[model samples]
Target: MTSNDAVLVLVVVTALGFDFTNGFHDTGNAMATSIVTGALPPRVAVAISAVLNLGGAFLSTAVAATIASGLVDSQDVTLTVVIAGLTGSILWNLTTWFFGIPSSSSHALIGGVVGATMAAAGSSAVKWQGLVSKVIVPAALSPFIAGSVAAIGTYLVYRLTRGVSEGPRGHGFRIGQVGSASMVSLAHGANDAQKTMGVITLALIANGTLESGAQAPTWVIVSCAVAIALGTYLGGWRVIRALGKGLMEIESPQGMASESASAAVILCSTNFGYSLSTTHVATGSILGAGVGKKGAVVRWHVARRMVAAWLLTLPAAALVGALAYWTAHGIGGTEGVVVIFVLLVLASVAFFAASRRAAVTPANVNAEWTGSVLPAPESKEATSWTPGST
Candidate 1:
């Protein structure tokens, strides 16, 4: 294979790696509420999400088209830039996952690619208008929209069921959670999985293998779908712990409301070709559920920290992407790309090893939250870092 071909291969692998992280990192978005409320077993919820997410990936390519052409000029994107972008996104995903912060993976990927494009081809290479309309504006508004809907839905659910006995009401909501959570999972697949397809398409275009304005190929779509599905099946237990238990104590009713709201907003955005962040929507919906329920405690501190992380995610990933581009460009040629890729792999291995030291497995994922994503020690459940912990 030629040098360019080799680089393309690496880029595809790296992009898929990012997709995998995106899956596990955001698994909580679709299934956390169900798992938390006992609507489904932890493993069972993830399995269902995996299947739905895979099916959802096949449902749309509009978002993929947007990412491939809307965010940046396809002509200016280079093999090195693609690799750098994926590197930035992958690192950021791992960082947030380790801390159990449910940050936006969509933004991370976009920021990385945009930042790398700017570094290699100047700011003019980025399509600012498309970024604003398709990504930025949606990011800013999705949370509020989803949150409002969730709050209203949650209020109505409680109000309508006020006459029912607690046992049946809770059981009914738990059953409802299954369907709602499944919808969110499907929506997540339609939205999040397309991102990897877009990146791969972008890389393909950058390499001149495909013309500009092309949609993702069937192979691209299938590979991305399977990668994300496997990641979802593995489950992001750390994030699941945080969203399911951290933001607020999610009940069956609240869980159902939040999941339903998240599914609606995400599916709408996906249909509109907006690269929305499911994490943002899910987090907002969960908080709104708390707001809607009577006397439910909303942990402002945890929400505050997550918001701060959301604000930082884009710029931070961009900075890393730019730096990676510079490093690769400085070294020059395929060797530069390989060096960065090797370093990235090493970094990933390091993070995985460190995580095992205080792993958050499904076994204790639902252990009572103690201001940490980590299970309390008495439960023999080791904990990872949390936004609340120093």
Candidate 2:
């Protein structure tokens, strides 16, 4: 392969890598409520989501098209810029997952690319109009829409089921949560997986391998689908713990309502070619469930932290993307890409090591919420016999 071909190959691989992180990082969006409410086992929940996500990838390409041509000028995007953007996105995803924050993977991907594009060329290269209409507007509105729907749904669920006994009501809702969560997993695949396809298509156009405005190639679609599916199967337990337990106490009825509302909003946005953040939608739906139920603990402190993360996600990822682009451009050529790539790998390893120190696993994912993602480890005194107290 020629040097340009080599760079293009590296870009595609890096984009797939980002897709992988997106998969695991956002698994909680679809499965967290179900797992927390015991509608499905943690492993079973993610496995079903993975399969549905793979199926969902084949459902539409509208979101993919939007990402390829809507956000920025394809002509201005280069291999270095694409790789740098992926680097920024991957790092951010890992960071948020480590802290168990359910941040938007969608914004991180877009912000990184936009930031890299601006750094490499200038603000003029970005299609500001498309960015505002397609991305920003949807981001602002989706959570409210989803939250409202979930709140209404939760309220109705209680009202309609008031005559029924608690046992049957809880059992029925748990069953319903399974189907609703599956729909969310499917919707997630249709929406989130497409972002990667668009990025890879963008890279292809930049390298002159494909003409501007061409749709994502068949191979691109299939590869992205597989990558995301694999990542989903791995499961982002840290994020799942936070969303399912940290945000609020989610019962079976609330979980069903939240999942159903999120799936509807996400699928609708996908149909309209809007790149809505599933994280925002899911988070809002969960919060709305709390609101609809009287006397339920909403944990506004946790909610506030999530809101802060949402506001910061775009700019923070952008800064990293711009810095990565500058570093790669400064080094000049394939060498720069390699250096940044190596650095990203090191950073990822560091995050992984740190996470292992207080790892969240399926075994303890459903543990009581204690105001943190990683449940505090069982103290030796609690687990073992100390002579002092019996």
Candidate 3:
């Protein structure tokens, strides 16, 4: 194969890898509340979300177009830039996942590409206005908008159902939570899956395999959808635990309100072709639910940490993206890309090994939050001294 073709192949593979991480990283956005509220089993919630995410990918190409052409100067993008960007995104995703933080995969991808582009070309290559208006403004505004909607929704839901019997009320809200959560999954697919498609499309444009203004090809759409769907099915249980249990204790009605708010905001943003972070919207909605309830407690400390991470995500990922670009550019050619790819693989393995030491699976995902992402250790005395044995 030609050298360009080989590089293009690598770019496509890396893009899909990013798509996979996007799926699992943000799965909690859709299903965490549902799982925590007993609206659906953990595995089942993710499974349902996976199917909806795949379906959502085909709903439109507007957001994909925005990603491909709106954020940066497509003329300046290169296969090398794309590769470095994906590396930055993947590493950031893994880092956040390991710490069980629900940072934005969307912002990471955008930051990586923008930073790599700046490193390769210059600040002039970026569409600064588009970045601010479409991305920055939306990011700043969306959380509050969603939070307000959720707060109102939560208040209304609780007030309206105040007279209902406790058992039936919980059961009814659980069912509503399932539907609202499903909409969120669909919205997430439409929003997040399109991001990888956009990156792949950008790569193709850079490689001259497609015209600069071209939309994402059908194959690109399908592949992104499937990769993300598969990743969603695997579930990011650590992130699930954090969003579901760490922020606040969510009742069924509040869960429904939060999911509804998230779904509405995401779907609306997708329609406008804005690639906003599902993580931000979902977290805000959850916080709103906590606030709206009469006696509910919002964990400000946990919320503060999340807000700090949100503030750091773009700049941190961009810094990594810039470094990746310099590293690859210094090494030169396909070899440089290969070297960075190898490093990414090694880093991923190391992180995975580290995570296994304090693994968060579905079984312990809903374990009582003990002020950390990892569950409290089972007592040795309890394990060794069973009542029957005693």
Model 1 residue 229 CA deviation in Å = 0.4
Give each model a TM-score. 0.96, 0.95, 0.95
Candidate 2 — which residues are off by over 4 angstroms? 367-390
Worst 10 residues of 1 by lDDT: 381-390
Candidate 2 least-lDDT 10 residues: 381-390
Separately for all candidates shown, the number of backbone clashes (residues 3 or more apart, or on different chains) is 1, 0, 0
Please provide, for model 2 over 194-312, each residue's C-alpha lDDT reduced to its tens digit, 9 standing for 90 to 100.
Answer: 99999999999999999999999999999999999999999998788778877788888999999999999999999999988999999999999999887789877787888888998
Writing each residue's lDDT as its tens digit, candidate 3 over 1-390 gives 999899999899999999999999999999999988888988899999999999999998888998899999999999989988888899999999888888999999999999999999999999999899878899999989999999999999989999999899999999999899999999999999999999999999999999998999999999999999999999998788778877888899999999999999999999999989999999999999998999999887888888888898888888899899999999999999888888988998998898777666776664442222433347321212111110
Q: What overall lDDT, based on C-alpha atoms, would model 2 receive against the true structure?
A: 0.89
Candidate 2 Cα deviation (angstroms), residue 358: 1.4
Better of 1 and 3 by TM-score: 1
- lDDT winner: 1
List where candidate 1 sits over 4 angstroms from the true fold.
Answer: 367-390
The global Cα lDDT (0 to 1) of model 3 is 0.89
* Number of clashing residue pairs, candidate 3: 0
lDDT (Cα, 0-100) at 1 in candidate 1 = 98
